[model samples]
Target: MNRRLLGAVAAVVALVLGVGALFLLLPERGQGPAAAPASTTSAPATPTSTTTAPRVLVDGPVGVPTRIEIAELGVDAPVMAVGTTPENAQEVPSSLDATGWWRDGAEPGAPGNAVIVGHTASVDDAVFDPLVDAEVGDEVFVTGSGGTVAFTVERTETVPVADFGDVAADVYRSEGDSGLVLMTCGDWNGNSFESTVIVHAVPTGA
Candidate 1:
């Protein structure tokens, strides 16, 4: 496959993953507070129901993310909006402490993969310096006008410029449930770009 085209496609796929989940209003993905100890002194005990509380998901207007916080990685950064670059590649955040979410895809709580891209290196601290260190099950919190949505890291991989097709299929998938994909350029491999680091996460309930 053409290297440049593949690279560009991967970038756009990442972009799609970022925006794909923007509209889905998934229930908060965390365990709620423990139920209070059953009343021990009550003369008559009230019957306890087994049903779980209904999950309340508020679908707000197509929200533009304002912030993203990954507590495990100590990454709390502002999110910016971007589109394609002049070279036709996806545009990236200009600052190291910020990430750009492609507005072309679904809004944050939506039912598709929302892609968030950032730089891995710069004169200052890389916005995603610890992204590679992220483990499955880690939490990613995105806050927007709609509300804060929580995502749990599900998978991470590095895709070479030449083998972008497989990952492209995965990231650009529109048939599945809501998800998020975080992307960044990794070490250079001499030909084009070295590889792309991607993290796939899904809304979590804890």
Candidate 2:
């Protein structure tokens, strides 16, 4: 073929290839065609209530106490972790000290009954807040390093500060089980006492 003719054919082929490449890379902007979506794109997954595990959980060491969280009222706070010692007892929240129930008992989610004590007075209004709203069968979720432990509210009552044993029925109810008990001044609403709110829960279903 002649040189001019060969060059013209080569130019036509180059132009076609260039146009095809542009279409593959760039989408038309103004009054052009809509860009096709990527076929490999995926949508986000939604959360579901159906879970394999139980709804309530307890967290922390087997014997070392930590924080307590109640989902019903968004009550997540750093609980004063105390065993049965003068120093450790002093560390207990003043509002929670009236009750002798200390860490000498069980740690959260442990084998035995884990007892936590708090106060109901408002000198600082620092504990047992909104205690009047608690109800039976309410689930209390405790959390720590171990995991979350679940408990049901067995009962709540008011008693005199002198009446401590009344709660023993609720606190030391059963044996050989994991449980949690929360006590606040409910005996007599005086200098350091008020309605004692006690929460009892155990491994009922699982």
Candidate 3:
């Protein structure tokens, strides 16, 4: 996220000064309460579309670095997943910047939305940040233990945080297209309930 777009959050945490949270810029995730892996060692991220298990976040569990390849922006970075509730959303760095779309609801290629998040403001947006340029017909892929799930970029838009809270049908819903929202700084002003940058995409194939 550009400093100007980051707004107050950016003001408080500036990458310009190189004092911002590096973890914050690392793409993150947010899902409903669910038991998952406790914790694990982190490995380096590569360009290989290898599907691997994710590291666990045990109580502020560090989000595993799941690589994201955006063919359009040429972005490649590891996106982190976090729990959606207030208790965990901010706790996960990956989720804080560009949190996960939430998996329990729908499998990437199954149906519903397959969301993911990451910081758009990075020294070099190798991953989640590139979503800013993602437009309809673009592609976003995530490699996890299950496998590689690719999503076609539907469109990008900002919505009230409250509305994004449990997406319904019309508000934050998309059936004609797979529902994948890569949310980020939208208001670039408010600290809360600003706006959400939604990069709509669907699973292309494995």
Candidate 4:
């Protein structure tokens, strides 16, 4: 994936210099959490349409995402602001219990994609272990210092890591109706994985 976004690159540099937390602009092979093989199962592909039912909008201050919850998946984890690493790739949280929110991008409930990433397998509990089982129409919620935003799953896709260029538009889309994306590495077995699991959802209500 290209680290062409100027804002993301700048944030990553700042994060590394000040906080000392490493952030990568792209997925560095052999540097992330342990990879696990994805179970074989027939799953639906990405939705062709972005159409969605009109959702109630919140007319107030929007806060930075602080946490994310997926009730069906038993996920209720902290959200930390993350930028790119010195290598110019997306940043991953140091702890598996936390999910990294792309700080340089849109916030939840805003007119763009708000991204959150996590690990599929961790030393403790797998944070996104159940992400592959996520189904369209499932519920997801994000809370920040500003407020809470609700969303409903619209699609799930597993894309080969090398083919990320094909879906770069959707992943880096910064203009559109409010949306949320959850991502984690998958199909990996200790060394390498073929793809990543991306859960796409849209804001439904406050």
Q: For model 1, how does the per-residue alpha-carbon lDDT over 37-75 read when each residue is reduced to its tens digit?
A: 111111211211212222233443237776788999998
Q: What would the TM-score be for candidate 3 when compared with the true structure? A: 0.51
The candidate that wins on lDDT is 4
Per-residue CA lDDT of candidate 3, range 107-200, in tens? 3444445445444443443234555566788876665544555566756776554444333233233234444556553443422224455666
Ranking, lDDT, top scorer first: 4, 1, 2, 3
Lowest summed-lDDT stretch of 10 residues in model 3? 3-12
Q: Candidate 3, after superposition: displacement of residue 78 in Å?
A: 1.6
**CA shift at 88, candidate 3, in angstroms?**
7.4
User: Local distance difference test, per candidate?
Assistant: 0.58, 0.42, 0.40, 0.61
Best by TM-score: 4
Scored by lDDT, model 2 comes in at 0.42
Off by over 4 Å in 1: 1-8, 11-62, 188-193
- 2 against 4, candidate with superior lDDT: 4
Error of 1 at 47 (Å): 53
State the lDDT of candidate 2 residue by residue for 1-206, as single tens digits.
11111111000000111110000111112222222222211121121111223233534333343455566754555555443222111113432222223444566666667776544444444445545567777776655445556677776665432343334434543346677777543433232232345566654354
Worst-scoring 10-residue span by lDDT in model 1: 17-26
RMSD of each: 19.1, 30.8, 11.8, 11.5
For model 4 the TM-score comes to: 0.71
